[model samples]
Target: MTDKAHVVIVGGGLAGLLLGCVVATTCRDRLSVTLIERALPEAPEESLDTRATAISRGSKALLDHWMLWEAVSNEAKPIEDIHVSRAARFGSAMLRDAQDAREPMGWVVENVLLQQVLVARCEAEGVALLEGREVVDFCATQENPKLTLNNEEVIDADLVVIADGAQSALRESIGIGAIRHSPSQFAIAVNCETDGADCGVAYERFTSEGPLALLPIPNGSSSRARYNVIWCAHKVKQAALLKLSDDDFIGALQAEFGWRAGKILRVGRRTGWPLGKIAARELVRARCVLFGNAAHTLHPVAGQGFNLSLRDVERLATVIATEAGQDAPFSSVERLSVFTDMSRKDHEQTMGATSQLAEMLDSPSPFVDGLASLALSTLDLTGPIKRNVAEFGMGRR
Candidate 1:
């Protein structure tokens, strides 16, 4: 008789829950899966928070496999066009039209809504989700992977996947080497109601202050559109910006954002996050592996962090399922290396783009700005460059 394989996943966020669903659905009666999370799977209200995310085509494809896309697509708005510009007149701005890619570029999502959908799907698929519990320690032997929770319950499995956040305690416990770099900028995020016409466009404007990204939000039949604003600036300036009255802050945002869309009214609370990147040197060892922020994190300049994590989860699931079907050692070093290879290209591309973009925006030299201006102008007229960037950003190519 075949032994029942058990899989344990730590962290109940998007990555963790989605991974659980994949295993439960693909493996079916072959594997038993359990997910542990510190927060209860509570329903979220309709109000928006500082929590927002962008889902790329790659991630959408993974969700579609599970028939979960419809759950989220309604809450997201397609980014039909994106305008990238600099605050200073010295630099040139580039416009990337989604039509060039023959598909919607991506969808901007609210975090709570994403969690609700994933949690519901996991429950329906027979993935055992344990809430109000945290993993206190994790140990992986050549034979078994064991997780001890704060409540003193222990779970042993044939494989363990870690989806914990960047500062993952379990990752540290497992001796995963990670490198971190501070971006020296903080992101201020808010949901706003526009007092003007609705335009299904996104903006990624870089200024001496920092990058300000305006993402479109879902609106009803009304012609007026809403947007989620994320502004990156020096930490001190971020604090001052937060202190401004709602109307005053809107005025400041309008001065930089222009009247293309109309007046911006605050619709949700504003929150801030320090910008940085963290990457683990190795994602897997023996029967244990890491995913999500536990493996890597990126600055929100491109909103690629969570999307990267989702890619990791999706590929990992595919690798394991393929190996299991062949009765091969899916958690073996050789098989896990396959998963690593799949992520390297995308991760490297995203890292390179974000780093280059951030450095160009932060640089003070006139020569560097001139070069950036030239590159922007060249990219506009260059169809290959524009198409390649759009495909890369959407995870299509």
Candidate 2:
């Protein structure tokens, strides 16, 4: 009886939550949105993820487009410059936001805070939030796709957006499989205090063992700046690193990261996970689609995962709003395929860049260090190439 198409989004992570917000805010007249989150509000304190994320300028624009930027910006710290260099190497690249002095290349935010802001936006926009639940299975029919909830509730929808994490059971229910890259690796993430003051600068320093990323995050009332550290390497090295005492870990970090952030004064508890490239073989089938880690999981070396997914969500919302005025909705198999095609170039470019960086990070060859150094130093001096790189990094292009 209703003209508005129903859109059921599975997973309340960043991707799904943002998708629900965009669709509900932009297409409220044309669509009804529902979001399913498996985790309940009473999640244990340890269950709340404190990891930080770097979002590009392009992503900020998308958030602004949906009127959610103000809330996010309040909690975000800007990245004015990104320093890329290999430890004890001759070459380095410094990329900055040259287009507008008022704008930054990117912003860093805490993951849990971002999710909270997104959930609030979804609720304000009238999105149905089904917390503490999940989609048990997908009924993928050609005309009307549907989702069966864990509570045995069946909801029919015109489109299903799967934004679950990498291990998505619903994605598998639809016969979608993910491919993991070879040569296993791991990354250790931690929060630490540095001896330097906060200048809104980020660093990517490559070393003999692997690439070290030190991203600035907000630290409360501390005299020295704080950072989120990601040290990636082979599993053997990762295990050895994780076993070190906090002081030993700080010492090890100070040795590899150098005096860039001054000294590694203090460190919080460290957490790590095995790293590998994972991507869905196909993104869309009939009335269903995949987004976020479900579609492609990239190394955080480049910090492109969430930003890339945000663009897709924004564009899809636009398409939904535009097509809602038509006699038929935009959730048809052919139309969804077209949407996937439109996003192909970005996904390919980002995934390729992240993979290559990760491979270089884990390479045992001494020559890779020199190659990476030379590439970074050379890319810095080339005006057009550097501009293009800056544009790509900021997601402005």
Q: Pick the candidate with the highest lDDT.
A: 2
Give the C-alpha miss distance for residue 376 in model 2, angstroms.
Answer: 2.7
Q: What overall lDDT goes with each candidate model?
A: 0.77, 0.81
* TM-score quality measure for candidate 1: 0.90
Off by over 4 Å in 1: 1-3, 40-46, 90-102, 220-223, 323-331
**Which ranges in model 2 have alpha carbons more than 4 Å from their true place?**
1-3, 40-49, 326-331, 364-367
Question: Would you list the clashing residue pairs of candidate 1?
Answer: none
RMSD of each: 2.7, 2.6
- Lowest-scoring 10 consecutive residues by lDDT in candidate 2? 40-49
Could you tell me how far off, in angstroms, the CA of residue 314 lies in candidate 2 after the best superposition? Answer: 1.6
Score candidate 1 by lDDT.
Answer: 0.77
lDDT of 2 by residue, 181-220 (tens): 7646789998888878689989988776567898888775
